[model samples]
Target: MEDFLQNLLNGIAAGSIYALIALGYTMVYGVLKLINFAHGDIFMIGSFVGFYAGRYMARHATGEAASLGSAALVLLLAMLVCGIVGYLNERIAYRPLRNAPRIASLITAIGVSFLLEYGGQMVFGPDPKFFPTLVEKKIIHLGTITTTNYQFIVLAVAIVFMGLLQYIIYGTKFGRALRAVSFNFETASLMGIPTDRIISMTFVLGSMLAAVAGILYGLSYPKIDPLMGIMPGLKAFVAAVLGGIGNVPGAVVGGLLIGIIESFVGGSQFSSYRDGIAFVILIVILLFRPSGLFGRYEPEKV
Candidate 1:
């Protein structure tokens, strides 16, 4: 029971990371009906950004300086850098193809993904870099479940960000504009909403979330490679679909579930095939609950 509980906690933490990145995939897809495949690369960039920034900060700090407060600051800086990178991606690569065919947009997104991957290598180099330690590796006890300070912090940040996004989507004017645009771009524009701006904002918000996820992942594992985002990004997309694409709450649910499943299955003797768990879930869900757990079924009107 204790072992199972510990695995559960770990799974939830891993899933939270997936959910954060998955939110980006679902948001862009829901609003624009575009997948934004470059999202993984955006996450990769966030890892690099956080890696360099954390290293620089550590280099200047006094010996053995590790605390929750300092960790929070590092995460904040990483979030900002990732958010800005996501905003720029939309402003430059995706915005121009807003009116293009889905195929075209997808191709453009793939191109952008390559650009970031190779460009990241060109600038940051191809070697994997170690992330500076921000948290003291102390495991916390929670009655049959022991978790690290790092896990607790990561989970807390993921929850806070998710809640903040929920508030923005449900309680803010910008969120209202986003919904209006999502429903119908032409009608939204007809009603005085700046459809273009809202679209851009959606991308920016999603990208930032992915970046944060990437940073958390780096902190969790302490090793980051340029291509790390590919698997996680793909899994996140599966999570978005599982939770019901376009549904914010669904994304969270799906992400956490996928993470947990992968962890348990991987922890078993089948660890070698852990990466395949997400796709298995994706296919199973599509074959059965096509609309997703939290996703609404919309029939096309004639």
Candidate 2:
């Protein structure tokens, strides 16, 4: 029982990270009806950026004085850089294929993913680097369960960001435009909604979330690798699909569920295939409920 509880906590901690990334997936899908497969690699890039930035700061800053408030600053810097990268990815790779077949965009997304993974290796080197542990404080403790400061911070940040996102989606003008664009781009354009801009913004927002997830991932594992985004990205996508591809809340639910399932499988079953569990669930969900948990069945208007 104790072990199960401990594992559950760990799963939630990990799931929070997945949920953050999954938001990016759901957002892009909801608006554009296109899966930004490269979003995960963008997450990877964010981790790398933060890892190097921390290392650089550590080397240059004086002893105690230098370390003062550096962690928060590093996180800010990482988020900014990663957000820019994500925005550019949307502008460069996806923008051109907006009117093309969905398959074309999907292929472009895969191409973009490869570009980032390989480009990262060439620039940062293929060797995996260590991300410096910025938030070293550990807080919150139970009988045998404990949460780290970084975990709390990451989870809080994810929740706050998602809350803000929900507000934007359901409350603000931009949100209305976004929803309009999602339901029907042509009508949105006819209504002078600036569909192109909304789509770009959606991609940018999703990318930014992915970047945050990357940083959180680095904090949790403290390792930097070009390929790190692959598994997490894939899993987050599975989560998005599992919860219903275009539903915002579904992404969160799906990510957390995937995280919990992976944790259990890894803890009790073969750890080697922990990553595979997400795909299995994805397949099962698609086989049974193609619309996903929160997805509504939309009949084609033939």
Candidate 3:
């Protein structure tokens, strides 16, 4: 029972990171029906950006204000940079391919993915860098179970971001425009909803979410590399699929579930297979319900 409780607590924080990355997958799919494979690279970029930003602050500032400023500024800077990258990705690489066959866009996304990954290694260095602590670390215990303050921070930040996302999707005009574009690109364009801009914004928003996830993951693990986003990004994709590819809430559920499963497996003797478990879930979910947990299938008409 103690072990189970401990795993559950750890899982939630791990799941929060997965959920943030998964949101990017679901949102991009919702808008363009294109899987932005470069998203993982964006996650990589965010961490690298945070690493440099933290170091720069360390050299220039001191005291309590520097501490507070570094945390906030690093996050905002990452978000802003990733957002612009996403925007340019859509505008330069994806926008022109909008009218092409789906395969073309998929290939282009793959090309972009490669560009970011290898390009990142060339620019950010090939070795892993230690992520600086943005906040002081402290351990917390519950009976025989143990956790850290960073876990709580990750969970809290995820909740706040997800809540903000919920409002953007349900309460704002931009959200409506996004939904409209998701429903039917042609119809939305005809209605003067600016489908192109909506698509760009979707990429921007999703990438920003990835940036937050990257920073949070760095805080928890503290070791980062250009390739760090690969597994988490893939797992998040599975999470999006598990929750139903185009459904927003489903992504969160899938991410949390995957995280819990990973935690349990990571703590067991079969830890070697921890990464493989996510793919197993992916295969099972696809075999049983391709639409995902919250998704409803609608047969396409010829």
TM-score for each model: 0.94, 0.93, 0.97
Cα error, residue 278 of model 1, in Å, equals: 0.5
In order, what lDDT does every prediction score?
Answer: 0.86, 0.84, 0.91
- Per-residue lDDT of candidate 2, residues 40-107 (tens digit): 99889889878888888887775555564676677677678877887787888888887887899899
| 136-250: candidate 1 lDDT, tens digit per residue | 6787889867789878878998999999999999899999989888888899999999888888789888988887898889989888888888899899999999999888889
Clashing pairs in 3: none
Q: Score residue 37 of candidate 1 by CA lDDT.
A: 86
What TM-score does candidate 2 get on C-alpha atoms? 0.93
Best by TM-score: 3
**Deviation in Å, model 2, residue 224 alpha carbon:** 1.3
Say which prediction, candidate 1 or candidate 2, comes out ahead on lDDT: 1
Find the 10 residues in a row with the least total lDDT in model 2.
60-69
At residue 301, candidate 1 shows an lDDT of 62
- What overall lDDT, based on C-alpha atoms, would model 1 receive against the true structure? 0.86
